[model samples]
Target: MTQLIDPFARAISYLRVSVTDRCDFRCTYCMSENMTFLPKADLLSLEELDRLCTTFIRMGVQKLRITGGEPLVRKGILTFFEAMSRHLGTGALKELTLTTNGSQLTKFAEPLAALGIKRINVSLDTLDPAKFAQITRWGRLPQVLDGIAAAKAAGLRVKINAVALKGFNEDELFSLTDWCAANDHDLTFIEVMPMGDDMGSATRLDQYWPLKDLRARLAERFALTDLTEQTGGPARYVRLAETGQKIGFITPLTHNFCESCNRVRLTCTGELYMCLGQEDMADLRAPLRANPEDAGLEQAIRAAIARKPKGHDFDYSRQKVAGKIGGQMTRHMSHTGG
Candidate 1:
């Protein structure tokens, strides 16, 4: 079997497949509430998704994560999950997981766990109801809490993914850590990345509280130690040196993890992105539509990998390039299926 190693010697094993580029919630950092989404016809069907997943597995992608604008909102998504879980269970893939906003997990959590999805990441930035509503625009804090409960009741390993938005939840850092510890859920604090109009020029850069400083703060409260757990994604895991509570920091802006980046993103419209921050990509829809065969599909995927960028262009400090402020992604996070 031939291996898939990029020019940087990073063996690609993880694939983040966005089933749709539409979400119900409009997070301030992700996109605008009045965002336009792709039409249904532009999305990749389950059949196409199957072929793509198989091709990726053949190329040594052992970890496959299903993403979406919000995957659960899509009709017949469970049926698709069932089919894909069965197929991947028999394939070379090591595990299948998902990342969601936990908005629609109430009815799907137990079913998801039954279908072999044990690990789940739920995006919940703050514990404050008023602030949650403000950040999500119209998101209900109770429904999301219920979703988290459902996920835990279904025997799923739930990791709370919180974005450290400036002026939003930075003050709750210590409290959030305690809350996660008390609830028996692992906590991963992610830095806020620029997506929608840079979330206002006055507040954009200020919102990014680096994980390096977060670690220093945690050290003062609890003994912090590096974790040796194998994570499916690029989160730097740490354990509380005192009680061994698990914590993670995904600092894409401050501490870029591009060198150890072994993953690629595929949008619902069949655009394969080599990196999330950059615009380096190939149109898989063209090849898949023209000839959805093994020969054609594999050739296109291999070509994209060959041309994958060595690293992303993410600068936390926001640099000036020819009088233009840079570092934010050219594409929206919602469209990228994050």
Candidate 2:
């Protein structure tokens, strides 16, 4: 028997692939209205995506997540899901999931559920229709809400991915929590990430919705409780006081969870990014485009694994430079499939 090697101290068992760098909505923290993405010719072919998924499965990947500039925006998306489902049928992947803006879920939910899409995480920041429209710009709040309802009806485990943006929607956090409880839905409140080309001068740790404030508000209304260690990664679960509602918090900026990070990202441009905040990447697209043998492909993946960073340190005090902001950041959350 051959002994398996774990190069990055952190055990990477999950892969998040960004199928495209293009999205329908221009999120404030993701892209500007004038932002231009890589040309269509730069994206990986569906065949290339399939080969990468197969190789990762062979290398002990257990969970695969399909993300996008809105993954559903890609043409022939259902066919792509079918291909991934077929490859995952080998029992190598324990779960196949997706993260979407929910704009297209109403039309694609049933077929996706049938294709073994285990769960879905929808990005919805506000519950108010008008406010939601303002945040997503081109998104129709009513349509997204309908899509969420449809996904739940299709028996897909549904979760909301809301970013806690200060001055924008942080005031609605508790209200959103209550709404999720009433709707029997799970909610994850994520901290805003500063990775876009236009973070400008407004992106700072001080602007984040402090966990202390969030926790205080929740504690007043709910009995916030921590989940057992075996339940998986740290989200810090809690139950609403009046209705036993469940809510989660992902405080990556203020309270870094890098030590327990268990995933890697594959970009649509064929680059393997070990950390969302890191600049290092390994290009597997070149080797795979060359139609290399299985061994050659495996070697390329292993090399990518070897480059994974130990962890991301967002704490400016702990960051290498002090008091000074560095040059422009490289990738956006959409490209990294956050």
Candidate 3:
């Protein structure tokens, strides 16, 4: 039987699953000082995750990324990976990746890599251990670094994701570039997303780390070169002066690339978010289980895909980053797998 596709003609090939909405670290930009997390029962169970992943695979979703406040923090994560890997072979998943803060990576890296998990991106804002503490209130930088080392030791493709907040970690750009070059790690500088505001964790524009200035400064130290479009995900790539070090920049604010966006996020509660910045989501747990028929379930998935917006418009000119939407503390990044 022929399958139905989304309005964009994209078969929703990628899926980012949020395992839970709970986190140990309280990063100033992602979580609130007093965050109220969801109950454990609300999160998708191991069986649920496996079932949903299989269903998504059947619908042409080939790549899967596990996200969370920190996916490693989720109990039975290694086992979950084992089950999913068994059900969905490594080749079946073009890329089965995970986004984490790397706090608990040391413990899970080897096991996860053994489970056929190939690539990993760890969120690290600063290299200085002290500043790392300040950025992630309760996190230990050593542990995170160890996690990175473990992933590398396990023979997995490792990448470091640093959210460049203007005044916060912007000063460390040079250090970060040098670090990535020295350690042979792909470092990506991400602009703080406006989605943080919806969760009541917005930062001012002044805090935004602009790529224009960063690129200029790096030019003095290294001869930067651009990469081809086929290189993959949004981050525009560049090489170091003499060495073969690769660095990337995710400049969503300065240069929004939503037109070529091919991402779909699955919230921890089983709601599918087609667009990162938009508020349109469709619940699949109920409909999928209510009617087990393939066509019936496929129709529901298509309906959600049809609702996907073309792009997101986050006003950068607004002074008050958290203007009217101040109750975003409700769902943590762990909940939506950001």
Q: Which stretches of candidate 2 lie over 4 Å from their true place?
A: 1-5, 203-207, 229-234, 316-328
Of candidate 1, the 10-residue stretch with the lowest lDDT total is: 316-325
State TM-scores per candidate: 0.95, 0.92, 0.91
Answer with 2 or 3, whichever has the higher TM-score. Answer: 2
In the range 240-302, model 1's lDDT, one tens digit per residue, is 977668999898877668888899999888899988878788988888878746778788888
Model 2, span 179-289: residue lDDT tens: 787788888888776666555344544455766677787787667766644323447676666776667777766676767677788999889987787888888888887
Which runs of model 3 end up more than 4 angstroms from their true locations?
Answer: 1-4, 87-90, 197-203, 292-295, 319-332
How far off is residue 306 in model 3, in Å? 0.9
Identify the superior model by lDDT, candidate 2 or candidate 3. 2
C-alpha RMSD by candidate, in order: 1.8, 2.7, 2.7
Q: Global lDDT of each model?
A: 0.83, 0.77, 0.75
Query: Which candidate has the highest TM-score of all?
Result: 1
Instruction: Output the lDDT of residue 82, model 3.
Output: 83
Tens-place lDDT per residue, model 3, 159-223, is 99888777787678788877877888888888776555343334345666677777888788788
